[model samples]
Target: QRQAMANNSRPTPTMAPNNSLRWERCSMDIDHLSLHCRQHSHTVLTEATPVPQWIDDRVSLTQVLEAMQASPMHVLDTEFERVRTFWPKLALVQVALPARNVLIDPLAFADLGDLGRVLGNGRPWLMHSASEDLVALKPLTEHAPTALFDTQIAAALLGLGSSLAYQKLVQSELGVSLAKSETRSDWLQRPLSAEQIDYAADDVIHLQALCDRLGDRLDRLGRMDWLWQDGQRQIAAGYELLPSANPHHEFRAAYKLPLAAQVRLVAVLEWRERTARSTDRPRSWVLDNATAIDIAQNPPRSGPELLGKLANCRAFPRRQVGEVIDLLASAEAGAPFQPAPAPLDRETENALRQAREQIDALAAALALESSTLCSRRLLEARARLGTWPPDCTRWRQQLLEPLVQATLGASSPTQNP
Candidate 1:
């Protein structure tokens, strides 16, 4: 029949949509699997001899520009350390074009101006789990990726595993599992070992292919808007070493303190930041939370008495003794207060609880952790500002705001209403 002829004539490609071969799941042989992948794949990692690090360093930057110009879309990844703070310091940067992969050493040559422009050029940049990468690079570059795509966003919409690992995504789409040996490579070192180099290269090289496959599926599923909104939220959140953040208002009743009490907390917070930066120690070490609370509760004036009160605190280094004493004096004099964590009433709570429910529902529908998508602080901001989460300003507003409205609309029937 005509239908039979039409079905038969729809030609299957020599390989897959990603140009990687579909290995017949039979005898389990890693060698056969690698062979199957390379023969039919256009992926960067499919190269028999992986170009781990950039060779011929003199013209490498120029070559990267050229390689990137031809291929407008590249994948980027980074490694860094930030166990102590909210932001990670970008230690290494990896860029993968469709045809090449190279890892940049941030420590060796800190100047990445050209590279930053290239990344920020409004060309689409793909990353998996992009939040950490965005935070790490904020200090180093003026512009983040202007056009960003998160493959994890796409995978979630496709009904794939909600928490897809990087390696699994590559394997699921590209049919290759990268070497696990270099999972902990210290990327900041120069003259990277062969294993480390290969691992780093593999980290980025497969991203484009994964993005392509996932992006196509996203388009087909009509979920591209979701991914776009998700990326925008992260892009707006930014990465900066803020001098001070108020933890006092973080508590419920404490937020209702008199203006002077609030001012005291802020002054103490500013002092803590200054001390931490000057000493290059952790913020908590500079002044423990309990100590800050105590200082704010009872404004300690100057001299031997104040010093003796804090004598039990061994963390107060000799270098900071004078500074700490001065900060106490400053707080005691006069401190500027910031008002409003949230209005203290049932109405505000209703609005906030509503925002939280919407966020929770949307997170479930999209298969991401709610906390990961939007924090409680952002939820409070939304309630106080009478707006949805910032990312909801875009395409997601229609989809997500309704749930927020439902939250704000009616109290529990169990209430006196």
Candidate 2:
């Protein structure tokens, strides 16, 4: 224990650890978690190094910063509520060092720039299913971590399931089963119960251990670079606040539509996206995708017909009807119609299946998942065009290029259906 500092109304500054990095978990008074929990004031006294250190004020936050400065790498996780807002409400931020775990209450403390700096400092962060957490990181620290070691992605690349739960990953890798009782609790509420705190702490508490195990497996398999590249891709995706193109353009229905209908769907979907952000509501509340499809396909010219179709959708506000009707009426007039190619015939299906079989055989030879080798969607598209493998990462292309060329080169007329 070292450093004498102010013992303000909130919990006093945790005893800053020496360079040895001996972090400890300590109890804090719950009544002082700011004015948000002023109504539910209570005194809590405990002595357990395993319990997370509750940080809700400036002094405690400063101490955490000091600890992070000593240790470049840390485990991180967040509890956020996204049901009611366009951006997630960052409720609690859990950060873990080898010897200590601390929960930072964003609602209580205002300045987290220090914590944000540590996150963005280009050090490796241990995380699980980090896409959503990266989004949640911004409002708290103002920046997402630069480097990541995502356990979920690493597990998938190493032949574990593509999408694995945090608890299951921990259990499989470390043989520890975590409790899920607080799975649906309102994280924004205060003061959080002891059980809630324990559960939140557990999310990050075991993550570092899993990262170590997964990293070892990937190292032995010599896919560490692959994991790093994939993690970077995941981080880049998290940075995209909106769709890369008109959101409707990604839908299967949009592709099946005539070019002019596709154009109209694009316009309405963009409108819905903008309205959803402005109103801070779900996309469905602004306009459902099914309704957008109907509007594009039918191209209702009259206001009565438009109203009749959308009449059942109460959330389709009447105030916006005039603009929507006018837009729908004129949607096809200027746009040129380009017909989509016919659906794949039985012969094309057979070709695609053969191409897929070749890829699967290659993937098995390399001891990798077929999906990991290349997505089925890309394979199917490329088979139609006689391009075996679609564009991919340089490392991935290097692995699949020879096999893909051989597969396409070997398909003779005799193999045709």
Candidate 3:
């Protein structure tokens, strides 16, 4: 049974300057299981004091899991590397429970399915800017947490500023300055440096207190529900593993291409996405965007021409040149291209402008960024489709639906065409 921490009124500990805290030995017991701190030395465990522990072995992981299972909420963060891969390489998993901060080594364990199961249990997870972290964690967790309280989302709802960096949020909420010196360190390297460990530990050390402050502010503003709804949306978007269905839409220059070339561009983009995912490589590594566009506009007739086009591109499969040539040939012989929806006409543009003004006024009244309440893209999409974006949250729809209807009308029959 998950139990909420009854007392959240703990003092926020002063962060060690420059993230240079030295470790001493300390020990504690949970349900009579002796647990020792791997990094920090604290004589007495308090709710405010973060006891950093390294979970490198199954035994340690079991202890950490037990502690985590008992907590109602956890402050979670991840350090990952994805410089050249489509998928994030999860380097470290940092989790903060009331008095314990854990640095779980994903490299040490081959499988973390058990850990993932506990994490996905109905209890809430406190995270800051959770989207990327959630993506990095999907390999282990397989799904988002049942409940998530993203500190960044909470901060935004309280008008603390949208997209606040973890360091800046910590500084703003707890008056603590954290160092970012080891941000670029190679987390896959064994025997992590003391500085790196310190940096990693500091990532989650203050999250509990930060979540408390932000959650309280959101509660007082009557926007906590908004934060939760946005958190769920963020989680869903983050964990969406498949490539976008309309990958061609991302290429702004594709619109200038002829209908046939545009169709080729769509096929090439889809192929690139699938290739990147299958090979665990980046889309650029498979085929760069500029090259993809060029090939679509002026496809090679033979293998040598294709080879010349891809000569400068590294990591692309030389053997796949024939395949790409064949693919382009098939696209040329495929059915006629269907043109995309036309750009907004002057009348629709005016309606979109009016909708923006009303949304801006509502955002100002709620002490939110206008874009945060409803982005211009979403507003424009509404004008084009004559319906609200399906992804708009309940709170946002409740506030903006009537205003949008008034400004843009209930529906526009000719808007989409």
Candidate 4:
């Protein structure tokens, strides 16, 4: 969650027209609707059904779980702080079911494993820009969600901008501008103010209806199945590099370095990862990227020299500096550095330029973003290596491969490596 605090400011449950109300009684209270009202401001919120309940215990969680199971879909959102931690510190979780919306306080309720089971039961989970929420949900659920309906991704397929904000998306599609007064609030603090609670609730309050609208739009366009497949593809792609032994996988900018520097970078990053995990602190707090890269590039010969080289190294135990020095020495001595293959030659480089031009034209013609076709890095890699990423889905290949191959030419010298 972004710390962009401003002020934020629910619906009633009713029985279905044709179905009996035996199993679906509205248990959440809506008498305190002013809990969501703005006291100081004159802004009037749009009328919506589905009252919210503040849930801070196991009983409330069970109640919400049963209600969610009764509903066909649910909206989910989370508020967390990640300023100085490797993992998100989950503070609040908002779940909006058809019957009512509820807030889950993770700090007060420690055992949420059952709630996780409910979320992981293959029911559709509606969220906006779900990547970070997916990370936050993993620790609670013991696994990531398999069924996702990301409103942002769905909107993108409908020709809305790919990076649309949640508030903007709701306003554009639903015409309701959410107040952002609490975007930067400290969610971990106890005794949350009414304003804070309202702000957090606003995150998921409109999600259920928003998902329904987007779903209908996608279905009419005959792209609903494609969106579902793409959601799964996104989940699979996110987990691809997460389990890698390469500690430097997240440092995308560092990959452009020479082969030997890359190896040394990996060594330092691996040590940093272990240290951060052990201490439950951020990797930067242990040794930031710049300092690590400096140590890797210019190894320190002695303990005193290491101290001199790293002014910020005092944060960690002095013994680790000695260990790092030894690790660098071992790495340097164990292997003779060999550079990776060169980038595209002159002819291939020109062809790659032409390919990008063609891709841009194709994207414009198809009313899609260039990134929706393929990322620049992926295109460059394909141009250089003469092959696509193994994980590229069949749908994407159908759209991209023929054009790329035509641009590469049949007799091109850049064969698959």
Record all residue pairs in model 1 with backbone atoms less than 3 Å apart, i.e. clashing: none
lDDT of 3 by residue, 225-246 (tens): 6766787677778887666655
**Model 3 segments more than 4 A misplaced:** 1-48, 332-343, 411-417
Estimate TM-scores for all models. 0.68, 0.76, 0.84, 0.80
Residue 123's lDDT within candidate 3 is: 63
lDDT of each: 0.59, 0.66, 0.72, 0.66
| Model 2 stretches astray by more than 4 angstroms | 1-49, 140-144, 299-319, 330-342, 345-348, 381-391, 406-417
Indicate the worst ten consecutive residues by lDDT in candidate 4.
30-39
Model 1 CA RMSD to the hidden true structure, in angstroms: 12.6
RMSD of each: 12.6, 11.4, 9.8, 9.2
Question: For this target, which candidate reaches the highest lDDT against the unseen true structure?
Answer: 3
Could you tell me how far off, in angstroms, the CA of residue 204 lies in candidate 4 after the best superposition? 1.2
lDDT for residue 184 in candidate 2, whole number 0-100: 83
Query: Mind giving the per-residue lDDT tens digits that candidate 1 earns over 1-417?
Result: 123222322111111234542222122222111111112344333334334455324367768767776665556888776644434656677887544466676765647677666666655567887777887777665866554577776676565765577888777777776678776656555555666655666677666567656765665556665566566655656544444355566656666656566667767777767766665566676677667767766766655655666644544576666666666556552334455365548977866776777678887876657765566765565555556533443444454556665655422211100
**Overall local distance difference test of candidate 4:** 0.66
| Per-residue accuracy of model 4 over 185-208 as CA lDDT, tens digit each | 899987677777766777887775
Task: Estimate the TM-score for candidate 3.
Answer: 0.84
| Per-residue alpha-carbon lDDT of candidate 2 for residues 32-149, written as tens digits (9 for 90 to 100) | 1110001112222222335577888798888887887777566788999987666677898998864678888888866677788877765566788988888888754555555567
State, as a TM-score between 0 and 1, how close model 4 is to the true structure. Answer: 0.80
